[model samples]
Target: MPIELKMPALSPTMEEGTLAKWLVKEGDSVSSGDLLAEIETDKATMEFEAVDEGVITKLLVAEGTDGVKVGTVIAVIAGEDDDSASAPKTAPAAPKAEVAAPPPPAAAPVASTPAPAPATASGDERIKASPLARRIAAERAVDLSQISGSGPNGRIVKQDVEAAIGGASAAPAAPPAASAPQAAPAPKPAPVAAIETDIPHEVVKLSNMRKTIARRLTESKQQVPHIYLTVDVRLDALLKLRSELNASLESRGVKLSVNDMLVKALALSLIQVPKCNVSFAGDTMLQYSRADISVAVSVPTGLITPIVKGADSKTLSVISTEISELAGRAKEGKLQPHEYQGGTASISNMGMMGIKQFEAVINPPQGMILAIGAGEKRPYIVDDALAIATVMSATGSFDHRAIDGADGAELMKVFKELVEKPLGLVA
Candidate 1:
């Protein structure tokens, strides 16, 4: 008997993926734990491993095929005792899976009369249209029954509804009667001509990672109620402390970055003001026990947050080294799901980019994100006297549903104190 190899979900949130490449061809011998194929999910490209030893019998899905649904059979394998020669060499018949499909012909039955009425099938029977197509039809005032379906089993789809609307708009209108006093027909507006220029441009298709980023960010803004709080903190002490510590640790190959110190300070503050370290669970609030910090790293694909687990417990050198390695792997798209998935809080430092200050969107399941800005010399009041000092602005974006404004302010207060004092971070 031939064993079917289905497309595996590379991540928990992965519903579909591209069958980027196949490692083995038909009749190739494979063993358990063998590399089977490269599956490209929305987040990363992961290798698929074989669990059972077998010979390649058939490739059900081809390489470069995108939007292959999870659980869809991608290949077939013959057991060691089974004869590979007897198994099928070609791919089995399957539905075409594409990231974007062309609009099919209208499937709804077309009514001869042009009156605005709901489209229906013959003898007032209901039309067979997809839910999306039905919604589009309602929006466009299209009659689904009059349009022909181009989908499977004569089902109406989005394209079919759109095509029907286009056809209706393009149809010739009836002429006015000669006996009636006719008003002058309004002049048709001229179509705008395309702007001609020598500027070179190219259309690049959106990658899965880019698509996921857009979707998740959109959801974050729309679903989460964000409250932003900004505070300016003097960073001279923290910078001086970092410089002195780096000098002492240079022999041990440990150099601490200001961002690393900030991560520790944030973790400690979250522990001090535990209310800020919570996730909004709709009917409940989930207060986290440990401060796992998700550090946002901008990769070529998009923004990814690789977490530094238990930041409060880890030493400054350890946090710095871990972040360096995690960031490098994240940029290369080599991070595992667990390495980037969950965290109690997040830190997005744009200070390196010279950004002064900006509000950040809350990554869901996490209550707040600390946005760090550039440290620059600015006028400040110290001991009732104004003086120039090195200062940085930190903004905390909190989920108002889970964390109170007072608690968020307290967290910011503690974070500022830790950075300004400098010793609390090391102690």
Candidate 2:
């Protein structure tokens, strides 16, 4: 029997994805850990791997194919002794651990030839490990047998493997490097009564990311009731601290950015005012214990938010390093799903772009998103007298359903104090 290759759910919310490109073709011999294809989802382009070894008998979907539903058969593989020509044509039962909608019949559990163990240190005994974990463990010369796994059924995942090595180097998952999200572009209109333009314009097709962004933002505005709170923040103390810290840390190759400090501040503020760090689930509200700040990084395809998990707990240098790494990977479309999936709140900084102020749309399910504006010299009262201070506008857009206006204001107040006092950030 030909082994069916169904699209695996790469993400919790991913229902379908674009078959961006195939890494293997018909008659190609594959191993359990080999990369088979690069699947492009709304979030990122992730490489798919084969779990079972075989000769690729057929490719059912073409490269660049879009809307391939999860659990849909995209290819076929024949085992070493199977007759490919006589393989029965049938609907594929989902693979092991596959989460299929209207799941396969319980009585007829899909039987399969066991895949060769992927663990690099396997002998008579085999350790179950993901291809990524196996690869990482091999590179690091770490023994999989010594480390227990945290993944499903004691299967080792990346995080588990990394923990076995020097754990501090492993960055915690935060929300993506995003705070202020660029408003999702307006949706494409219906075909009827379409306007024809004489002015020259190219019809740029929207990628999965753009389409998802549009649909999601449209839904956020229409569904989530948002309350906006803006606060003008003094930057002199924070700027002074940043410069001193950067100079002292120069020998260690560590530098902190204003945005990095702000990420920390926002996270600390969320911890202080837990009332604002909540998501509205129908009939229930989820209040996060720690803040996972998503900072937006712009990529060629679109924007992606690679999280820095516990921003408040991490040092400014650590936060800066993680953001740099996450943002770089995000641009390259190399981030794993876990890096950007969930967050307690978000922060989008437009300060570098010189934008004075703007309200950022809430990334749904996350209660609030903080929009940061450029800091500039502004007239203000200092020491009970007229003075000029470098100030930036920080706006918190809260989901009204989950958080009250007063709670949102308190969060904003705390965020401002952290920035102005500045020492609190390092402490």
Candidate 3:
């Protein structure tokens, strides 16, 4: 019996996918777990593997085709030596021969294969259509190559077409003759070029992921009574600790970043201020006993937040290891839906991207999101004297319906102390 090769669900929310390319042709023998095609979903480009070993007998969809729903049969594989199960045999010699040959000479041009003609429309029957013309035609839904030219050598020149469409030509002036040179005289005042005003034009279709982002963000902003609290932390000690940790862990293939430390800090702070870690549920608020911190990781397709569950209970080293694996899997689109969704609190770090400070939108169901910015060297009062220090800014967005401004500020105080002191986090 022939086996159907259906489009596998790359991610939980992925419904339809685009078949980017096929690795094997029809009739090629394939093994189970072999890469068969590359599929593009709303999240990432993933390699779809063949689940059954057999000869590829049919391909229902071509490459670059989109809107193929998940579980749709895309291809078929026939069992070995089963003539009845195999695809109907068809002669492929003629198409192969045509593909193998070099194009014919221009003297005897074939009508089947169209060649580009000159662009100038002289008195001849030909029309001159430039490559730009052909591109414009494809974009504007015009058939330039198909149109019969009224100009020289079947050329569809710009002016002739404009005239045919009842439009005037803003023809360019010809350059001066190269054979005759003019003498240099007094310089004339050069006219300033008119600046083109930027027209506010925006009508592109929204991508599936973008549409989801829009809907979720709108709901979050409208329903959640948002209040923001900002705090500045000294990062000199934290930076030293990270360097020492990374130096020791380098040989073990574990890289500990400041963001990793922040994850731990947030988790520890959440444990102290349990109220800040709660999420609002309709008329009631639910406070989680365990701290699940969702760290936002940017993938090629879009942003995804993967959770590190029970982060408050786990040591910093464990958080580092788990986050590394989670980020790696997230980039490859190997993360399960549950692995990314359903966190008690979240963190969005733009510090690495050179962002000084920025606010973040709340993820649905989560009452708070911490926005972190880059550290910069500045003068600060030390022992009643000004001294150089490294400081970083952080903003906490809390749901007013669940958390108050004073309560959020208190939580920030604990988080700030944990990050600035650095040694206390381990202690």
Candidate 4:
């Protein structure tokens, strides 16, 4: 029997992905765990491995095809004993099994075109519109029958519905029935209409990573009630300790960074102030036993947070090594889902970019994110006398729903104390 290779869900939230490239072509013999295709998910471009050993019979989804839905059969594999020549040759030709949904067309640049005539018997005839357009039409009370579609096969997309709402006379929709089994979901913001301009510019489609980042950050700002607390921490002691530790470990090639120590400090502080290390699960809060810190690493596609599991319990050298490796892989778009997914808290250090201070948007579910700024020599009180000390401004953005203002402040205070004392990080 021929084996069907369907699109695997790369991430928990992934419903679809781009078939970036095929590592194996049709007619290639594959074994279990062999590389199949590189799928570009919302977070990263990860390689999919073959689970069943067989000969590649047909590649249903071509390379560069975007929006391939999960569970959609992307390929057909023949058993080792079966003849490869007996399998289907062309993609359009159906295999032995039935395929419900075909793969989407290869990615292409989007261009707006004037739609055809509007105002037809939408009641009798079936309406051809995208799901997003239908949703927007329902919310804005825009009659689809009065609007012309501009998408493939004259299908109405979000832009079409938005245009109708803007120019077409739309009557107000009646309120949803209260006796309905479930309430209507919150209306998502409509796509922004393109503006006419004379400025020379090129339109680039947003990558999955960029799109996800935009959507998530917007949701965070809109939904999460944030409480920000800032504190200046002296880094002189921590820097001194880092230097001494690096000198002793020079032969082993394990050098410590200020950010590495700070990672440790933040994890330790989370352990001490357990209230801040929590996730907001509506109507309840989840407090973590150990701190898993998500360190923000900027990749070419977008920003990703690779976690250091149990940073509070790991040694500074171990944390430094692990961070370096994780960051390298993150930039290469090779990080697995688990490596970048969940964390008790997050830390974003823009110190290398010379950013003085900036409030980071809290990643959803997690209670808070610590923003680290550049450390510079500044005047500070030393033994009741003013003296120059290396100091940095750290800000904590807490989800007011899960973590109280006092808890966030205490986390910051403890973080500051750990950094100033320096030895507590190792202890």
Model 4 alpha-carbon drift over 4 Å, by segment: 81-86, 89-187
Candidate 3 off by > 4 Å? 79-215, 243-255, 281-286, 321-339, 381-387
lDDT per residue as tens, model 2, 1-427: 6777766556645667889999998889997667889999988998877756678877777899776766567888887788866543442334322433444433212111112334556461488777877888899988777765543234565655655563333222222212212122234434347569999989887899998887778778887898999999999999999999999999999999999999999999999999987777656666677788889888998777777888879999999999999998899898876777777788999989999999999987789999999999999899999999999999999999889999999999999999999999988
- Local accuracy of candidate 4 as per-residue lDDT tens digits, 347-425: 9999888888999999876778999999998999999999999989999999998788998999999999999999998
Model 2 residue 20 lDDT? 96
By lDDT, the best candidate is 2
Off by over 4 Å in 2: 87-195
Overall local distance difference test of candidate 3: 0.68
lDDT of each candidate versus the true structure = 0.76, 0.77, 0.68, 0.77
Q: Supply candidate 3's per-residue lDDT for 337.
A: 43
**Comparison by TM-score, 2 against 4, better one:** 2
lDDT of 3 by residue, 14-52 (tens): 556778899999879986446788887665566765544
Ranking by lDDT: 2, 4, 1, 3
How many backbone overlaps does candidate 3 show? 14
Clashes (backbone N, CA, C under 3 Å), per candidate, total 12, 18, 14, 0
